[model samples]
Target: MPHLVILYTPNLEAQADMGRLCRSLADTMLAQRDDGGAQVFPTGGTRVLAFAAAHYAVADDSDDHAFVYLNLRMAAGRADAVKKRIGDALTACAKVHFEPLLAQRHVGITLQIDEAPGQVYDGKIGNLHALFAAAR
Candidate 1:
């Protein structure tokens, strides 16, 4: 089944603040789970992951870009809302960790959501090897 990769630009901090933002995003998603079995990426090197917010840094005179990259797994049809929910969670998270930085500019509040389809796979070793060879 295909999953999703969501990337956004939101306000973030310089040092430890990035780590704090990643955790907050995870916490927000986990709070909404009803056994959804979703995973947030890069948070401890899992499939579902979160990178340091500063990893998204883009150069702009406006200082309006702060990037947050997230990857999560879900069944085929769950992409749309999951993307929006991530945005919402990010907005909330930014308010706490990055608000003081962004409040001065006001222009940094925008979120650009980049959503992409992903894949999920499960296999036994020899069967997987056979599948790969067949594809080639």
Candidate 2:
């Protein structure tokens, strides 16, 4: 399971399209493949969620500064190379998306990938995966 969560300053919402960015990042996640060319992430197990912080402070508490943070959580087992590829792809996509905003204002973009090991407890129940399988 891979869930990509995006947290960004509310000020950027008007200048950037969060919905479109979500879809773009989701597509980037879906594009990742393993060494054998198999999809690294299950199509249905992929989810992208974005939340605009209602209140926040960034770098010296200046309202002119904005930030976007992306956290990708996935099941462990992939190689470090694989994770780096995913992170790089996602970051590139985001950079392209925020190019305009970056030029207009002072902003910081960061992406981090977290792998869930056995020590981490993950609980889930969903029919989305089944639906995707059926469609195939």
| TM-score on alpha carbons, each prediction | 0.43, 0.95
Top TM-score model: 2
lDDT of 1 by residue, 5-117 (tens): 43455344343255555566566654442237554332222222333343455666555655444455433344566667666775676567666665554423444454334
Clashing residue pairs for model 2: none
Question: In candidate 2, what are the lDDT values of residues 1-116, reduced to their tens digit?
Answer: 79999999998878889999999999999999999899999999999999999889999967889999999999989998998899899999999999988888999998989877
- Give me the displacement of residue 107 in model 1, in angstroms: 6.9
- Local distance difference test values of all predictions, in order: 0.48, 0.92
Hey, what RMSD does candidate 1 come out at?
Answer: 9.1
Q: Mark the 10 consecutive residues where model 2 has the least summed lDDT.
A: 115-124
